[model samples]
Target: MDGLSGQGPAAADRADTAIRAIGLIKDFGDTRAVDGVSLAVPRGTIYGLLGPNGAGKTTTLRMLLGIIDPSSGSRVVLGHDRPIDAAPQIGYLPEERGLYPAMHCREAIAFMGALRGLSLPEGRRRADALLAEHGLGEWARKPIRTLSKGMAQTVQLLGTIVHQPRLIVLDEPFSGLDAINQARLEEMIRTKAREGATVIFSTHVIAHAERLCERIAIIAKGKVAFEGAVDDARAKLRPIVRLRTRNADGPWRSAIPAGTRTSGRDWEFELPESGPEPLLRALIDGGAGIETLAIERPGLHDAFVAIAGDAAAAAMKQEVPQ
Candidate 1:
């Protein structure tokens, strides 16, 4: 099981959900930060809270971690009705990165673990091992001030998981990371999940969520625009069809749907629900000179555009809060 428990079947089943939020809402003074967001994160899986900047991803994460109380609604983490009661079993990395510049890298990690009730000596031991395993062994005694932004972020991430919490919540963990460090962080996330940790992370980059999460919740304007398996998200839109034709105006043009448009030498449209066999047969029978034809699967970005529209799509490019 994902949790460190010896409960029976029924209890184990109850523990299957690492986190659940129902109708969550958070209002900051006059501004409503999050509204009516719900999510069920399965145990031992990588769950992504995906949204553009200022779309409530951070707020929702805060609510889940009990860092902030919701204006209304409820949340459960690690089977605790109150998320705060489950804090010992959770590891959280906030969106804003912070570390004492004077603190050594290993001590910083150990200090974080100590905050979660781990003994300092054990925390330090785990910290040293984690840094070394992630190729930061040489920097063990170095102060946080010496590390680059990416390295500092890495040090903090190592701290987040040093206690090995059952539920790890990271708000935009990919931020401030270079490509190489991003790849390393991804590998670490996968390693933790394989060890039966339930990892929930927020990210505006659809590509990170695309590559890492088994399930994702797409938030837009403080609400969940879509939620389900990543594959389901990709399945929202039909396959795309791209064709290169020798003749643009011909009887075979009838096989092309009305919405199909010409792009350079290619004709592009959504593959009809009935399947491409009929369309291909029609084009062939009509003697359309087909130079090339490609059927493409929709990615998470395309599905986001389909579900949340263009405004939500624009958030994917934003790095700051809304």
Candidate 2:
């Protein structure tokens, strides 16, 4: 296995790597869908590929899954040099969902397992158990068309994992699901990772990545803007201080940072290098009549805006109608 730095993996890390893509590029005519993207997903971890629509997230996933070949670069999946060589050990749920409309839920799931070499009988058994576990026991025998969109999507996901692949890849797995189903899927993802399967999912929704990802790669305009631990991303930006004071012209205003901005009586600014405690004491001592004050640490959303810039983040937000 190769490390993220393009070197041989260390002894302690060799066995922990599940997926590694280095300088992956994909071109469609004049456009480059994925531009020299590189990522390493560790085993038993939930990694997220985050970007707005047309940001090349899907293209990169496809290349990693061997559904499409990259114009250049290399990837290793589950110790295999090529993704197809490790296909049986990988479960992939594409962004575009598809299932036989006339097939029974159990049969559909079993068929998916069969593709990964599970026996029909065992596949059916596992499918039934999985359905029961996911609160769809009664729907096992029902036709796919009979289930709601959420239920069908759930069935598709169950099929993807019925064979217990060592690595699971989901492209836009959260698309179109309501809040409840989204939460359910989140739990399922956590469960899979807990069971020691590496899970990689792509989404434009910052909330999902913030909630579920230990590591994430933020893609913008077909380029990876940031990739690393979620905490590291958030750490790149300073904490914000929001305050509302009755005495807007008080001497304590000097405590505000140089780049501070005001909205009516409210003042919002990044904390200074000296931190917020000094400013708080200054405001109190100067009789600034503070009505409210808060120091907020930046989250993944703020990190995205900071790293990808306001224009790209705005474009991403607008891309997802959800």
Candidate 3:
């Protein structure tokens, strides 16, 4: 892909969000799960909270949702200083699955809706509608125990949004979902955002962020390693381009250009800061069949590796002090 200029939105168009957390810290006994983390989520966009399992993603969400209080620091969700007071405007789907096993799907979902202040009739109506929308209409009366894991997860997801909260926090919303269901969930999220709700979710899956999130906050070792637009995050990475050709082993191997290197058919390379047009022309002149040429901005996974690797190396160096 030819270098496309800043793709998404103008700087001014970037929505000004109200999620602010200053030195937010949460601990579990001797373990510090969230260590002085701060973040700002823009309004009217999909934000992703990403990290490996046991990396405090769940703990952080709990703190934000008022299910657990922070050990220290402060947080303001949708301008509400008190997290509990912010509950009415926030919808949270927890990491752990929980629905009354004995209750019918619609009833269980409606009950969750009630917790968000929806009345019985209103909750039931929405529950019935979402059950059908999510393809669980036929199973609406089935007990939670009788539903498949995917089905129950769908019900739980419906419960999260049934009351139409202004901000939706989904914890591993794609977990246990097959590709088809995952696609459906992704579509659901996009639709929700198009309808003007700010959706933030936590995931270990990086591609989800690449595809859907407008902004991402990546946490490693209980701290944020990076937070910004996907393109901006990628831009911070050293420039590398990937190219594919008709011949895997070609003469180009011996004639590698400066700021470039070859690895079989693949290359981890860059061009002169001046421009890439010359190099682009050189490949064509060399009879090298260029099937695909992509100017790569390192992805979230690459950034994760670079950031976490550096941190680990620094920690190891500290441990070995002279």
Global lDDT of each candidate: 0.89, 0.91, 0.79
For model 2, residues 1-322, the per-residue Cα lDDT tens digits are 3545665555335467888889999999998899999999998999999988889999999999899999999988887777899999999999999999999999999999999999999999999999999888999889999988988999999999999999999999989898899999999999999999999999989999999999999998889999999999999999988899988787887888787899878999998889878988999998889999999989898999999999878987885646
Ranking by TM-score: 2, 1, 3
Give the Cα RMSD of candidate 3. Answer: 8.2
Best by lDDT: 2
Clashing pairs in 1: 54-322
Error of 3 at 82 (Å): 0.3
Which parts of model 3 are misplaced by more than 4 Å?
A: 1-15, 243-268, 281-294, 310-322
Order of all candidates by lDDT, from best down to worst?
A: 2, 1, 3
Candidate 2 lDDT for residue 287: 82
| Cα RMSDs, all models | 3.2, 3.0, 8.2
Minimum summed lDDT over a 10-residue window in model 2 is located at 3-12
lDDT for model 3 = 0.79
TM-score of each candidate structure, all chains considered together: 0.92, 0.93, 0.82
Error in Å for residue 1 of model 1: 20
lDDT of 3 by residue, 229-251 (tens): 88777766766667877776555
